[model samples]
Target: MTHQQILDKLSSKYLVKSIDEDVARLTYYAMCFEKDHNSQFEYIFPKLMLRWNCVLNADKNTVTDHYRLITILALCIHLHKYGFADKDLTAEALKAIDKLNEAVVLSDDFFRKSEEIKKIISSLPVPLKRKPSIPENITFYREKDVVSIQLGNRFYAAYIHRLTGVNESPVIEFYNGVFDKVPTIQELEKLNAKGRVYNDGTERISHFSVSGMKFLPDLANQIKLISACVEQKPPHQHLEKSVGLYIVMDIFKLQDEIKSIFKT
Candidate 1:
């Protein structure tokens, strides 16, 4: 039987918690028991029935002897639960204890091997971490109500406005824009003429559609920048203290406005 199977059998009888339920406490107890199962009275007792205390003069040896008797009773209960009326419960439980001891040894060896392998891998020279090709900074160009975000030398127009009205999901559009100049009608016509095989043998550069995921991090960074700018109020000596306080309060609201868009 597996360690868990044996644990289940024992737990059902003694009513003590298993390693899975309380890993730290049970592991400590198991390690203590492995060292000298007879000497550990504090852990041997069923937690439901007996409580451990920090008393120096307590007869721990006697407690352990009593706990051993209770363990035998647990084995009998385990056997009875499995419909083994005539089985030698004491002998069977001793065998199970031997199996658990063997399992603990195997577990310890596996852990030791794992640690050695980790050390060996750690000693080997690792490859240098590569930097992302995309730049972190996103430049914003605001021309009236339209806001264009520049990413990787390419501009993308993004607008934030409610589609329906109050309590409705806002419409956020991020489409392609001109490289540096404001998109002219002639430039748009040039863009439309991409991938055309003319008799003069001229092909315009392919208009690559930008993926939303690529600009998402840059968009988040823009929101954070807005929030930071709002937080850092400009110093003014001419203003009254109360007026300055009110201005600070309004600036906090603006910061919230920046963050509120990302709440969903």
Candidate 2:
């Protein structure tokens, strides 16, 4: 079930009456935990595990809504896998576990790395904010038809579409990449898309434009971008936002691709 669907059912059964209100409350609490896991945050854990077994917030970690659900479901599944069942075990719980294990295992690992990096960054002293510098150790090299991006021990694949010989652009196709989800071009176009409410209460759409190749930079740059932001700035929520945006974009792309295939 989608996050909202799960939220709807849970809210109905629990007599919460309003999913929006519940989501807002849950999101606020989740944000607090993401910034710092403390006893005050402990109360929500039991309720989640015992009642919902899910997080309904769209941007719990600043990623897409689906991932917010998956992130919660992964933990729920892990708990169940270790022989800890919730108060009420339903088929939905099993389905969630199976879907995550079968479909998004790699994506789960990717988020796990992001979490590890966040912890490492939080423990380190504040790094001096020098001019944004790309690490020299990182390299992107093409061998045969494949371009490999290497940073430390991690490697990602980059694709250069030159066969058409017209307006060749480098992209990392979602299916060909390490990520289980990728955003569509349409989704990327909405990077800066936000509604601004004016003093008079009128709203206007504003957006930031992100380049295709910019998002497909070498793996090192992606890591550095998040890590540097964390090291230079305390309260590393930016790290989650950055990684979340990439994940959101990839997922949109993947969805669009699947839709097109079904159409044909």
Candidate 3:
């Protein structure tokens, strides 16, 4: 189920007066943890720790709202995963559980409503897996086809050059010109001949994975070969072994490098 649906069900069943934005976000993160273990480690763990620290420092009179209760339950679940062996962490978990029990006291004081809430959290469904970075249906470009590269409002140009590296992976060679708009094939050819290499005189070329290549616009009409302004050499000798090392050449890094080179 989607996180929103889970939140709605929780709100309706528990008669939660209002859903705070922080509670909603934590619920989403908790559901994400249920879906993928990697997401829990990479994204949710640090945030959960921070929330737990806040609970520790909170004043006695501070209101323990829905957000706090959700945080406590998430912490309890996380501790349960670690086998609950750390004495201090176990004490903190027990303290948080007590706070939840105190905050959730009903009229008769007989119902351990916190236990029911924990059961609901434990039963949240695992969500669908995430989609791939590059969709399967997108077409790839052939050699010498002009492609537009977008960086925020501006556009740049590059083309699918021949295979490089020991593995014979395809590489995209970027030209040294930025455009206010997407340039046509003829305009790109003119830019290519301007002999505008970087200050170090090295041509800007880098390997990209097929997934990373999806960011470049699809191939332009087949055009005549645009020869390099100078003798072309490998941009970085250390990157000769494999395309994996060049993953850092993704678009954002390229944008920063281009901006720094031109001082734009």
**How many angstroms is residue 137 displaced in model 2 relative to the true structure, after the best TM-score fit?**
26
The candidate, 1 or 3, that scores higher on TM-score is 3
Report the lDDT tens digits of candidate 1 across residue range 147-170: 333222233333332222232222
- Runs in model 2 deviating more than 4 A are 1-55, 59-61, 88-92, 95-264
**What is the lDDT for 3 in model 3?**
31
State the weakest 10-residue window (summed lDDT) of model 1.
243-252
Question: What's the best-to-worst order under lDDT?
Answer: 3, 2, 1
TM-score of each: 0.16, 0.19, 0.33
The local lDDT score (0 to 100) that residue 44 gets in candidate 1 is 28
Clashing pairs in model 3?
none
- The digit string of per-residue lDDT tens for model 3 on 1-264 reads 333332333333222211122223333444544555555333444443433344443444542454454444444443343222234444454555566456663222313444543453344334324421221222234455556654444666665554343323335655557776666666655543212234555533354432223212221111123333324322334222332333334322344554664556
lDDT scores in order? 0.28, 0.29, 0.40
Q: lDDT of candidate 3 vs native? A: 0.40
Query: For model 2, how does the per-residue alpha-carbon lDDT over 1-264 read when each residue is reduced to its tens digit?
Result: 233333332212222222222223333444444444334234334433322222332234534434433444443333332223333333344444445445554345443443332232223223122212221121222111233322223323333222211322222221122322233332322233222234555433311111222222321122111111111111222122222112212211222332332221
Give the Å shift of residue 130 in candidate 1.
27
Q: Of the candidates numbered 1 and 3, which has the greater lDDT value?
A: 3
Pick by lDDT: which candidate is best? 3
